[model samples]
Target: MPNYWGPFAQLKEQTNAILEVANYNGLMAELNDALFIDRSDIAYYVDLAKEAGGPILELGCGSGRVTLPLLSGGYHVTGVDNSQDMLDILSKRMQHRSREEQSRLTMCREDARNFQLGNAFSLVIFPYCSLLLFTDPADRKSILKSVRRHLTSSGLFAFDAPVQESLNQERIFELDLPIESGKTVVTLGIKTYHEQKVMLENSLFQVAKSTNKRYTILEYKKLALFAEGELEQELQEAGFYVYKRIPTLSDNGKTLRYLYVCGKSDTDTYPLWHPYMPHNQLPNHVLTLVSGQGCRVTDQHGKTYIDASGGLWSVQCGLGNTYIIDAITKQLSTLSYGTLFAGRGNEPALALARKLVELAPYPLEWVYLTGSGSESVELSIKLARQFWHFAGLANKNRIVYLDQSYHGTFFGSMGVSGLYPAKETVGPGLPGLDCINAPNPDNCPPNQDYETYALTCAEQLETVARLKSDQIAAFIIEPVLGSAGVVIPPQAYFDRIAEICQRHNILLIVDEIATGFGRTGAWFCSTHFGIKPDIMLLSKGITSGYLPLGATLFSAEIGNRLLAHGAGIMHGSSHNGNPACCVAALATIDVLTNQQLIKRAREAGHYVRELLEQMKNEQPNVSGIRSLGLMAGVALCQNDHKPATKEQVAVIYELLKRKGVLAYPAVSSVVFFPALTITDDELQTVVQKLGEVLSSVQLVNNGTRMR
Candidate 1:
């Protein structure tokens, strides 16, 4: 009675206690064998135990099915179950085993969600949809959190859940177990769902033929079904990194269930300092980046590595440029804090805005400052809706986003998001938000060319606009899709998109969060497309990782319309025009222009691109390599050309880290957004170490690297 509510409540009300405790007296064990003795699970666990060197903690160990096998396989096993009857049966069975075997087995009757053993384990396995017993996601998360706290640093947590589609819906499945010579105990299971919660009516009979003597067990289980890529997202959020997913097979060797094997992500950054983490995972290590010069940063551990991702694709002038640092220091001492509220603004903010307007493409002249990338998106969305509202076009309220493009994490920002797994936990976002398929060459149809695919993607937006032009406000896109493994669109894609948006009188927004400030060869990735977007969002490199600063650059026409009729736009952060951030951004721009790093980025980016291309040619696992300036990604694949598995991704990332190269990891690719100032020598080491990492990541059948 843990204060169950929602879906969990539905399950508790449906369950009958007599049914739950009608219990197992060796009949359940025999019935399990008759149903489908999935010995593959046994082999899988044994292999994992051998590799992880486990003293296994088995949750929901009903009648010691897998537990007995594990003990026989030389594993120290602890079996915990909520059912005392099941544990009593297991204890009786264990009496016949040898003294050594008995010593290896430990039993406890406890619930998986709240059980504690006072010792950490290398492997924790919750087999047979025991997870489904906890109907609430919070309860399941609690169990997972407990699992993490009880696991060794290098340990693995694993579980199996029957797929939603495979749950017996027809009620025709049966299992027969013989007790005496002629008498048989038969169990027929009838599975049904009420409001998405599963009910299994298991009727046990004294004999195979029906005579009306039967005992019924009403088993109620509710589980959160995972979407295509959602389990990975959930696992990461819960502080576990899923390394592998193995199929749990039935007696006939067909796939009856799926198992996830995960390791605790090293994220104990517990001093309450998680500033800009996107995925809600705790930081792996609380790294106070002590000091740096050029493109390398030193952690408190005295270890240094290339600032590969530029500290979240910022730091355009590289780390420790004393010019920018001195500028920030001076600004902090001077006009340290200034608010741009109530028609009051600072000199630094106005100056920076003026400089950006001058540097931007001719169409985008007006600027709106913000605190971060997500805030910039929020402001842009607000500006779009308000512009139409003040202009008497309030019907146009929706925003369209490209599939797989990460705009930001704000409510309105995530509302127009396309990657559902990432935002599924967030509440239902703003109404009238829509998304169209992005132009991904990798996702191009087998019958279509790249240009055809690009135009097709453009047409999808047009169709949406045509169908709901009055409801649509703007169509948003990322110049280079960053979190979707740095996917680059076709050359003519943006031009077509611009034409369509103009025809429909829809504002076209481009997010240059990761590709701005010379990370791309151009000053802005929007410039690479040669399309002046109606509204443009910028961040990341704005203050060069020195401070949080962002901007929304839009056309003067929209600004004029909004500022008309005494309609003041109500959007501003408290530190909107903070002078310290402004000066750091000014100095960052000065460093980029004076050093000609944008041009240098073009040159250095070419060298890095060529090196990665050569590596791609030499490696069998390399599927594709994409780069626009210093922003780059190398996709790893198996023999079939599909993206690499998480285990493969982990192997590659771990090796790169060991070789003193830090890279941003995606689901299937390793991304690089190293500082534009990264040198040829660093690039050489990057290529060489990458080769070594690829050479070392050949996975074998035994779940270890091939020697």
Candidate 2:
């Protein structure tokens, strides 16, 4: 944690110069005799080491200050420092100890900011104010992450930092320790304050006590400072929770320092913000996925489950596909990475774009590559407004989305989303955005047929378009709502919607991020509906989750006009059209086409639907079932036919997990999106397990009580 030679090479040089003085041959002994003579902190650190149960790692351990004491206390210690001179000094002291005592100590010269011990420790200690030396935020983070990696799951990371009051002023002092009858080691300490930190400089010299004459300079040293609370926040952000803080005062009773004891929040300290997941209630036993093959994934516990979620509805070609992996490997060897910006293009990007257009629905002649589904949706919104701006309809900038729809999680994309909670949680929605109810067959009137309900829903779009035609830029919809329990619209719905949008000059936007790449028995859901959208969003299965990639496809009518505009598409991502991602996408498409997975998806859809229908027939709790190709959901309900509670949905999924099936729970339903290549036996096993789980959870009287 000390600055070392990184930005304080002058300090290192000063130490080297003082070491070269022939008069100061025994400098190590002088340092311990003068500076650390009355270090009351050693006992406290020893007790912590006992509680932590070493072998311990002491970073930035100068000489044998803390390391030797810990070794003497019958504990194994590994001393790491960036200076070889300090390690050599510690090694020299170790030679004087017995063989067993020497064996308890190990010294390694390594940077405190970055080091690989290739070993785990029970306690990792950064004594002194070493952590404060790392003023750079990146360096501090690196050190904390390193400590976390080297610690055992139950281990502790303890470090002492100076208090803000300690560094408020500068002070100087001198200490004399008798080395012999007439000779003494004199230590001069000087402290200074800077903008946010304090610097301590110490110089050691040998002098005659009687004459008070300086003999030779033994060593010159500098230490770093840190502010209080700064380190605690950094520790939490780095996935560590400080359970204890032991404050200690200086020998003069003026300065104060605190020793923080931290433990890993959990083995999975990713600090990742999972979408739609509540942070406070995160399960301690969360599944740690390690590896996967085909339609099954194995957790860290070595248990395998049928990946019914298909990696969030993206792994259509299955997990660990070699074709995609090899394509990515090959692309990495050749280009590695290249951006499609300022007209600079890579081979894989160009080839992937051409391939997308070839397989895309009719008139989707151009592809704008992005980094992910959210980015794709975000770019599409920008492009839509850009087109209207070019066509002299600058006022046509309003975006309309359907209710219960999830487009993406970006600002503009989330703004156009219809989920109430999503909008409320994100604060404000983008201006000029509106929402209308989607065509859900389940929500139809009692007497209306499927077509009549579809027409009724489609009329909402016409009403909005007519009322806000001057402001409505585009109307976006997911052919099948994947996130909202995989709601499948009636066939008549898209036919009516396309007619209405075209008549009102409202651009139709299709978001097939989840349903794309043959998930719904076709390349894209727009094709199945026989509707040509002016713009389309795609991701997830584009590369089958091999890498991050997304695309926004545009029809000729829009692509050409946007191209002719002088302003151009005013946007791009740093990794947009990344070569490796493009290659993975290309390989995924090839796998889908060559292996005829699209045809298999259709066959799988038929098999899944039949099985789900039987499960529904057998269990009254299985009140509703809806599916399209590989994506399917079974809604659980009470005996009176009301939607199940959130608790009930959780219980159902836990049962499914216990039965070796991994399915996602969306509201009151359990959704399954198995890999396209999943065998019929696997599919039957998953559905059978689900049925068993559904039959076990029966509500008595619709009061939310399960038997």
TM-scores of the models, in the order given = 0.66, 0.62
The lDDT of model 2 is 0.78
lDDT (0 to 1) per candidate: 0.76, 0.78
Clashes of 2: 0
- Which pairs in model 1 have colliding backbones? none
Identify the candidate with maximal lDDT: 2
TM-score of 1: 0.66
Q: Could you say which candidate leads in TM-score?
A: 1
lDDT of 2 by residue, 1-707 (tens): 23222213354455543443422345544445445557656766786676566589999888767888799889999999887777777788888899999888878889988899888999999976678767677888999989989998767888886665565344445666765334655545546456535465555555654546445454434445556566667887887877566665574766567777787766454566566666632333267799999999998778899999998789989998898898899889999989877779998899988998888887789889999998989988898898999999999999888887887778988877676354676576688887888766556676888678877878888888888858889988898886667787877888888888778788888898998999989988877778788888899999999899999999888877866764678779789989999999999999999999999999999999999998789998877788888889887777877777776777678668867899998756889888899999999999999877666557534322222
**Clashes per candidate, residues 3 or more apart or on different chains:** 0, 0
Off by over 4 Å in 1: 1-292, 420-422, 645-651, 698-707
Residue 105, model 1: Cα distance from true site in angstroms? 28
